[model samples]
Target: MGKLTRILSTAALSAAIASVSLTAAADGTTNWRMATPWSGGPWLERDAQSFATHVRELSNGSINIEVFPGGTLGSALKVTDSVKSGVAQVSHNYINYDYGKDQTTALLAGHSSGLTPEEFMLWMYKGGGAELYEQYRLDKFGVVAFPCSILGTEIFLHSNKPVRTLEDFKGLRLRTSGAWAEIASRLGASTVVLAGSEIYSALERGVIDAAEWGSPEMNRPTGFQDVAKYVVLPGIHQSGGVLECQINKKVWDGLNPQQQTVLRDAAKLSVFDSWLSSSYADLKAYEELKNGKNEIVRLDPSFIKAVYEETTKWEDEYAGKNEWFKRVLDSQRTFKKDMQSWPEYRLQIGVSEL
Candidate 1:
């Protein structure tokens, strides 16, 4: 009705629009501190860094993740507690590291007794493994978990002395952990559990005769080849291992749906990047090691058969006692059995009859 009234109304509308725009721009902006157990390795640290970068990019800088390598926030083995206590908003760690807290973690982290890495990833992504993992985290530690890294078969063992047969493991002091430690003990090798950071020094100082850290790509950066001359193949003890990013439940719940989706997608991307990088690096590393002084040893077929037999027995014994272990193990085994026909059929159809 009046010139002054019209001018005031336009100004008020502009102020309201500016306020909404600012709020929308600032929404879901989060800075999360991420910790990892890997201190010096190439793959682990690189994977964590790339995952952080992916999250920030995917969220359009709304989420910023800062990663701290192993021992900076705390011991890698204690990363679970670090996330739970809110010392860190997130952590990259192997689930089996917390097996002492919940034995079922071994099944989720690294139990090679049953499935290969590809099979395990399939079960985790397509089958019900992801839900089970999330439930395990919520039920046991009050945290949220994502499978951030999945490694192919690792080096079974890197030894100072050649181990050609099952009996060669006798009296050998080996550095390993989880159910594999139990299996090593059963095989008459004295098992010593050491942190990844300590493996090189332990082997160099002759404190341990052998160790099994990861793939050639992972282990090469750690200088295991310098200390141990024998690189064993077919990492049966840790067939397909997974590293997960654990986030505080409260922090995870505080995120909006879009932020949560970015986090999950970023983790999945890290898994792909890590597997591809490590696979390529491992092939190159194998070539280097083969050309160099270190000897690559494939365990004798008889010895491998014996190890498998012992591993099966160990699984049977544990399944009888632990419900969670039995449940996860059975799930994997069933999946493996059901999928076996596909590979067999493919091989049959692809072969020429000539």
Candidate 2:
């Protein structure tokens, strides 16, 4: 064959190889279903939706996630089970809701031991808390998890009657769950566990005297302000809330390295975005509540101190009972202790508080 004919044949072979490579890469595309523990319309649900959007965009549409807002697949509290059973490839929910399965779950979600939102984030990302959490999920549920959302301090409680001191808690029927419920019970308040959707009606019908949910932005959408005019502050039980995104282990393993990196970074971005958006919304909600008939009251300092003491005692007792709980608590305690000194030094150096 002549030189020109040989060159033409080589070019045609190169084109065919390129087409095959493109097809192989395109075949890696995936579509996943993600379920959240919150119903449609709340800031939390919006955060979950935003996370899905970020993942898709970051993956350049090679991976698409369809988010199912609260209870669409099943009860919100059972989201972990849904992901574990492969009913859903992913889920966004507070891990503390599953504290019944293992007390350590509360440490990842929200614990009353007094870590602020920033502190929790620091511990999770830098202080080795994230690794423990990931291991716990894999060992217990056969799933992979990430901290996808972080909430500012929650409102302590919303009440029909004013709560002035520890005495006021006597005979008060409260709707809450996890360690907070235990603390409330010790304080003489009868505690009941109610789903998020049930809180408004329960308060309106006088089924419960008080309840604590999310931040002002989250609670406003539930219309808690309308049902309970007296809003308490300084959420002592839950200083902050963390939402986790869990994926089925098989699904997570199927992802390529780049896809895994996108998922991880997308989750971190969601955590930051949710924190900022919720903080702004809470400020606005606070202003609106002030203008309305609602009265926002801060819990008395002495009462808060008492609650903190109780929380410490409860933490000791519970940690002694569960090995995993002890492991997480020890890790957080060490991180908190090490970081606590810096803030003191900063204050001494005259840095103004924010």
- RMSD, every candidate, angstroms: 11.1, 11.5
lDDT of 1 by residue, 1-354 (tens): 699999999899757533432132346666677878776566456888888889889988887777887777767668988888776788888888788876778888876565776777788888788778888788878899978888777888889989878888888999998888888899899999897779999999999999998887777778899989998887878788678888888888888898888888998888888878877888888788789889888888898888789988888887899887788888877887778787655555225883
* Candidate lDDT values, in order: 0.81, 0.81
TM-score of each: 0.86, 0.87
Off by over 4 Å in 1: 1-28, 345-354
> Per-residue CA lDDT of candidate 2, range 1-354, in tens?
699998999798656533442132446766677877776765445788878989989998887777887777667779988787666778888888788887778777876778888787888899998788888888877889988888788888889988878998878899999888888899889999997879999999999999998777777778888999898888888898688888888778877899889988998999888877877788898788778889888888888888888888888997899888888888988997989777655554224665
Question: So what's the TM-score on candidate 1?
Answer: 0.86
Off by over 4 Å in 2: 1-28, 43-45, 345-354
Best by lDDT: 2
Among all candidates shown, the one with the greatest TM-score: 2
Model 2 weakest 10-residue run by lDDT: 17-26
Residue 209 lDDT, candidate 1, scale 0-100: 94
